[model samples]
Every structure is written in structure tokens, then in C-alpha cells.
Target: MLRERVAETIYVFTSSRYLEVAAGLIMTPQGCVVVDTLPFPSESRQMYEFARRNCPAGIRWVVNTHFHADHIYGNYLFEGIPIIAHEETRAMLERVGEQALEEAKQETPELREVRLRLPDITYRGRAAIRLADYNIELIHAPGHSSDCTMVYIEEEKILFAGDAVLPVPYIVGGDLNQMLATLQKVQSLNLESIVQGHGGVLLRGEIPETLEAAINYLKKVRSFVHNAVSKGASERELLAWDVEKAGLSRVPLGGMAQELHRANLLYLYRSFQKERLRRAG
Candidate 1:
């Protein structure tokens, strides 16, 4: 069921296992704009029904913050709708979306079939759409992914930041510098509320402080990797070094420490390789 957080204006739809992540819906007189469609079709339908009852106008726009399966798999649920997303997002979806859906089907036969539908409308830098009651601004924040974008409600001052601003470092496949730059760009926005693709909503006032912490964490991870590389540490050794430096040995395998820190290490490794190549050149 969708929980009414700020009335019909904003709603949260969550999954059982994915408690850290919640899809958001914005209601307007014209229709409803959904941000980050959940992974499963059932969850998407639940969100759709909630929005229909709350708005009843229709779903005019569906925004896939990124090309992640969990975010865009629900696009099939809103087929024929004018889905809007970043240009990179559309490209990535076209490239890998089908494979993701097929893989999911093989893994979960009981789940409803969801097709991979690329966004019909895509914007490069930024795009602003005027809905029935509010203006939705799509800002390109390429951190977590090349196509990651943040949805900003201008009047409400609420930003639906995809996986860009999470509580922990979830830098699975991204450039560390680019992600840091994206976070800096997001910090510059005049936002009153920050909603992450994963994790609960955060007030705007808390953003600056939280952003600082995130940046510092990334820097520390980078430093650790750089120093280890300088000492000719292997990947396995680097992993152990990270565990000691970050004090992440206690968290569960699938928990924040493991997932987030693993991604951070991968990013650090890539960054180190790039720096080494530049120095060699």
C-alpha cells in the first residue's frame, strides 16, 4: 500500500526486501508523474493504482531516474506513456534493458512479465515540464550512473535524487570524480526536501551536511586505494585494507557496509588505473 507522506502531493511505495528504496509519486491535476518505477510489476501496479485513486487523471509522464532494472523495469507497466529521461538513460536502456528484463523473468517466473521500454522523450542537459499544478525539472546528475538524473519540484522544493545521494557509498558503476561533481551540483540546488531513490526522505537543510560527509567518505576511500596501490597492494590486499580502514568488517554481507564499500573499492580501483595510465603517458 502507498503511504501518504505529504498527502496526495507526495507518496511512498516500498518493497519488502528493498526497504531502503522507495518509489515516489507526484500528483497533479493533469496526471501523475512517477519517479523510479520499482523492480517488480506488482509493486508498479500497486503504485499505479494508488496514484490513479489519488489523482484519477492519468499517468502523463513516467520518469526513469536511471537505467537500473529496479528503476525502469516498471516502465513496461506504463507502456505507451511518454516516458521522459536523460539522453544517456535512454541509450543505456536501449542497450541493456532487454537483457535485464529477460534475466529477471528467468529468475522469477512467478513475477509478471515486464518489457524493456526505452524512454521516448530524452533531454541532454536539463528539461522542465509544466504539469497540471507544478513544474518538474529534470537535472542531470551523473554520479551513480552515466544517465542518473534528479527530479526537482520547483515550487515544493523537493528533489527526487535517484541513487546519487544515498546514506552510503553505492558507486557500483560510475566515475568517482564525476559522482563527486554530481553531488556538488546537487548541493547547489535550492531544495527544501531531498528524496533518494534508496533511503528515506531528507530535509533540504540536512543536505549540505550530508553531502560533506559523502564527499569525505569518497575521498577517504580514494586515498586508501591510492596508498595501497603505491605500496603494490593486490586487489585482495586492498579489500582487506579497506575493511580495516573503513571498519566495515561487522556489517552483514548484503548490508550497507558490504554493498556500498564494495562499489567504492571498485570505483577506487578504476580511478587508480586511470591515474596510473595518465602518469605513464
Candidate 2:
């Protein structure tokens, strides 16, 4: 139900589950291509129904931005469709698909009867999917997640940036440097709009500035965490460091953003320690 027509033939749907997880649908002459599927089965079904009513042609393909649970839980509902994603995405799903489903089952009764499904088509590096009127270029951009890929609709001049772009950029176990690098690369592309997985949309003029802002945030976090690590800061102290005190603006994360941020700090700290140990050895 959380869906909207963002453009002439493009529709976006968000799941109410959490983080307002978004998926996109592009209606083409041949058929419809779904960018990502919602989290809950019911919500995802509704999304499909809406598409079916509006789009007479059946689905041509389903693309997963990443293998994250929220973005991929509805793969079952999309049976027989050629599900496509980055090759690494398929690996991640194969590695953790069962475990993620089990955990989700424990979290909500809605997921109790759900089954995990994976990508049928996988590509490494990049791929060009030729649609009837548009060309979708799947760029494997690893940052927010190792399997993350940005889908650029050529003719429409819109980019469906998966988890690679967020309202408040969040880095889990991904490489901080790689995140910045990918953002910079995406900035150079000529695009009219960017549809993020979370936090709605970014228009043409606002795109560069917002990408820079996100890059700056990641840089500030990395610098602060690095400095803290250099000063004999314990893991607890590193985790407790305030982002605001580090001169970064507060972002809406339901307070759990701090926990994730701290976890990022921990990841950086561990990386630093490993490097130092290697040098010492």
C-alpha cells in the first residue's frame, strides 16, 4: 500500500516494516521490471497486485538491490520471474539466506510461514539489461553492502540506487573507503534523479550536494574513530563517542543508528589493530 507513481512509467513502493524500505517498478513496452520486492509477504503481494492492475504486461524481471532481508523477502512471491542481482549478492544470499529467514521468523509471526528464495540470474562487475524502451545498467557498487548494486535506467535518466544510498548513509561491515569511492563515481554520472532504498528520492540539482554530504559524514566518522583508536581508547570508549561532538549532524536512526555507528567504529578499530599487528610481526 505504501506505493506512489514517481514518474511517467515508474512506480515506487515502500514497506512499513522498518526504515521504510523501498522498491521500484518500471513499466516498459515488453513488460514490467521490479527493482526490489518488499519485506512482508502481504505487503509485497499488494505491490504486485498494484502493478498487475496498472501494467497489463506481465513481469519481465525482478532485480534485488542487495541481499538484505527487507529487500529480498518477497522473492518467493515473484516465483518464475528471472530474479537478477550482482553475483556477490547471490553468494551472500546463499551463505546467509537460511539463517536470515530463521531470524526473521523469530522476530515476527508474519514471517513464520515464509520461505527464502534467491537470484536466478547473477552478474559480476556490471551488466546491461536491454528493455523495450530503456536500458538498465547494473553497476556493482560495493559499500553499504558487499553485494550492493546501483541500477541506472538509461533512457529515463534515473538511478535506482539500492542500499548504496540512504537518507542517512549507514555503513555496516562494508568498506568505508569503498563507500566514498562509489558515491563519487555515481556523482559523475549524468542522471536526473536518484531513488534511494530508504528515505524517498533525490532530484537532479540536489543529488551532488546530498552525495557530498553523505561522503563527508563517512569521512568524519572514520577520522573520529581513527583518532580515538590512536589515543588508546578502549572499545567501550570508542563506541560511546558522540557523532555530534565529532561535528556531524544528528540523523534519524530510531536511536539504533548510534548502535550501528558504534559497530562501524568497532570494525574500523579491529582493522587498524590487524594492520598494526601485521607490521609488528
1-281, model 1: which lDDT tens digit per residue?
34547443777675654545667888888888888778777778888777777778887888889998777777777767789999999888778777777777888874446777889899999998898769999999987888888988888888888888877756777777788898888878887788877767778567788788778877788788888778777778766644436643434324565566866786678678778889989
Q: How many residue pairs clash in each candidate?
A: 1, 0
Which residue pairs of candidate 2 clash?
Answer: none
Off by over 4 Å in 1: 1-4, 241-254, 274-281
Candidate 2: global Cα-lDDT? Answer: 0.83
Instruction: Provide the TM-score for each candidate, comma-separated.
Output: 0.89, 0.93
- How accurate locally is residue 223 in candidate 1, as Cα lDDT from 0 to 100? 80
Clashing pairs in 1: 20-199
How far out, in Å, is residue 58 in model 2? Answer: 0.9
Query: What residue runs in model 2 are displaced by over 4 Å at the alpha carbon?
Result: 245-248, 253-256
Candidate 1 weakest ten by summed lDDT = 247-256
Native-to-model Cα distance after best TM-score fit, residue 70 in candidate 2, in Å: 0.9
Over all chains combined, what TM-score does candidate 1 have? 0.89
